[model samples]
Target: MASIVKRMKLGSQGLDVSAQGLGCMGMSAFYGPPKSEEDMITLIHHAINIGITFLDTSDFYGPHTNEILLGKALKGGMREKVQLATKFGIKRVDGKIEVRGDPAYVRACCEASLKRLDVECIDLYYQHRIDTSVPIEVTMGELKKLVEEGKIKYIGLSEASSATIRRAHAVHPITAIQMEWSLWSRDIEEDIVPTCRELGIGIVPYSPLGRGFFSLGPKVVETYYEHDYRKDLPRFQPENLEHNKYIFERVSEMAARKGCTTSQLALAWVHHQGGDVCPIPGTSKINNLNQNIAALSVKLTPDEMAELESFASAENVKGERSWNKVYSWENSDTPLLSSWKTVE
Candidate 1:
């Protein structure tokens, strides 16, 4: 079957996936209450049929439900059509979030995710958050074993610092680095982006639409549902949002000049970052998914790219990228390899 979405090599490794992946986190968790299972299944199928094959989700999303949902959606011979990616290491226990990367936990999580995803081999598996308690090498050692066991084909790290990425890649060549990278979330560009480029690792930018701010604008905040977590995000707070809205406004103005929707232009910017980049923008609605796919066609020249960058330069943007300090890339480094006994 011909694919509408062009495929690219995600890393120097043999892992190739669609140019743009589908982030399935919102379908079962985070943004709001769980969406209808039937609807999400249909949406996943629609994405695959349209050639958006790289599906991203995590056990942390819906705790466990999202993987189960993907398992269901991949039935009826659909699993073979796309690259499946899921994550582990972040768990909510007793109302507190904990990150673990011990070898025992790594093996358990991988086995559990395999069962939940109902797949023989996961194409890409990422440590959702760096576990500071364990050495990066120790955690990656277990993942390296998974590759040899054929449990996972490729390894990835999320929200990792340049140093941590370097350390983890030494243990096992990291196929990709998943980070929050959008127009407003540009901190990663200074170090993380350069590190990945230097190591020849592919970068998968999550929240490439700035958590929907660039698309829906400040007015969209008023429509948040009761459980909408975005309402509590720093950038979405009334005080910061008042200032941040201007960034969206400027992006909207440029988008209008380009004859595209604000969301399309915002997504296009990520698409244009480079061929090594693939942005996973999540949407529960088919219309939004189609619109995001159209972003691949919204080409940008060097001058326009610089103009867009100026609108959301770090100084002009307000609020922290994440409310939790644990998620900051600066805090993503794990302990030194010598700090822990090497696993045999």
Candidate 2:
């Protein structure tokens, strides 16, 4: 029997989910080679059994295979037990990744995701990335229509600017905003996070474990396979990796003092951030899943929170989160939405 985890509401629209979600991308792609289907299915069942039911996946993951995998696992009455969240808008065309938020694309993606997941409606559907080419209003309007049509239950935006979020929410109620938020990736706190709070939009922090860097230490990057996405990330470069080791050491030392693993300490920090916030950490192993579940109990003191804050400051961390400049649009420090007018 799995333990019961607390639930948190992700938007004023009454979208509530477990305090932590399971990011399913790693099971099908990224990090290294894909895990066996049987193992991935078993892991998801274990997640549901343990009450970690807010499951996250994107259509682009495996380009389409992950949704099929979830569909297979969610069969046999497991579908009703979890809140299924998947993303759209990210596509690989002609060997390059592109974001498409056009209303037509939105509808197509939703329909395809519905078919792939074998679900009547998705619990939460997020626009994976803002297609700067499309007006946020237009995209939100299309999503609004989907809710009315019973294709999706809730709406969300990932890696969108605060202004974009406001614009989208104005068009339709946004249930959640997923972004790269962890002890090391705290830039969203400057504005995006506050904006979510003001709009009653829930904040779901993806890569809350900092893509396994925070949990496995800085040197873990060197162990990534040639095809691993982390290999191209600037922060994982040799020089930058060496520079960022201090962050891992600082958190590890604290975890040791608390008698918890570094990963648990990092997750505890995320859990302590707020009630409306949920962190979805990814893993392909049962042991890591259990360790992450245990983080719900690893509470931190106010002083400890402040200490970790200083240790993980952006100024102390080296290199950009991504090596490709195009991906930087997701960063909170980017220019305001007014500068990047959406296509009319």
Candidate 3:
């Protein structure tokens, strides 16, 4: 908690939160492997005690499992210490995605999340993906009503285009926009950032660690598990990883000179971006959580920021940031954070 989180409201009148939030995605799945519930619970409590206030989760992770986990984690007065955010709307079947933002579904999802998280209200609710099957106006309109009913505090969108964002905003002023942001990705800088600023919405950057690629991330996953999803991703392939290490390789060297790990540098880099930008880095280990908390204190000078950017600018990291989906489609910032995503 050494670095004061430059927290701002997700949207004007929205709840205040730590400048950097905690992405709860990795605790249940993704990255290298699945973590035990006991370990994840410990990590969640640790994160809370350390003043990391933003708690992120979604119904999609285990198709209702992650939210349930968080519900159990917040069994006590711990719920009062957090600014919880959970997403709904993206439908999943057999591990494949099916975007569904129907208004009826939105209400149903909200109730389910409430029951899963064991909370009276979700602080900030988001549409996990833009459901083209239903109009954005129709979906957001229902969300506005939820706000009125006090079922949710604020609304946010993920992986949505500028047009969709604007349409949603017209229905209700968005509190924050959650998506992937890191030193490697820049797609939102040009449009999304500007729009959020103009509308007074906050930006919550998920995977600020580049899916743990910035430092100390394993080279690969041998076998896919029921909860593990990274094995199917392109970046995990041996061929891509072999070439992609170049992006973070330099980061490791920089960390050596700075007397920190590549992970520290990555988190520091996220903090240096802007007061409005909050990077949520997820980890299920107490040691890593401690290290992540320490990142709030890792300072980078303007020159250092430029240097890091300069070094990352040249390399083309292999693999795609997202699989074949509209949200995973090409964007500008992908090259910087997702440099290794397309190397192969």
Could you tell me the TM-score of candidate 2? 0.95
lDDT of 1 by residue, 162-186 (tens): 9999999988899999999999988
Residue-level lDDT of model 3, residues 1-344, one tens digit each, is 34344455556755799766788877776643557888888888777776787999898876677899999999979899899999996776785778777788999999999998989999999998877656677788799999999999889888776777777788788888887877777666787888888888888888888776775654435434565666666776778777767777888888899988888898889887777777788877788877876787888999999888875562566776666556541321111112333442
Give candidate 1 misplaced runs (Cα > 4 Å): 342-344
Winning candidate number (lDDT): 1
TM-score, per-candidate, Cα-based = 0.97, 0.95, 0.89
Cα-based lDDT at residue 214, candidate 1: 80
Q: Per-candidate RMSD vs. true structure?
A: 1.5, 2.5, 7.0
lDDT of each: 0.92, 0.88, 0.77
Candidate 2 error regions (>4 Å): 328-344
Which residue pairs clash in candidate 1? none
User: Sorted by lDDT, highest first, which candidate order results?
Assistant: 1, 2, 3
What is the per-residue lDDT of model 2 for residues 1-344, given as tens digits with 9 covering 90 to 100? 85578887777998878889999998878778788999999999999998899999999999899999999999999998999999998899999998888789999999999999999999999998888766788788899999999999999988888888888888899999998888888878988889999989898999988899987887687668757998888888889888899999999999999999999999999999898899999999999999999999998999999999888898998998766645443532232345546412
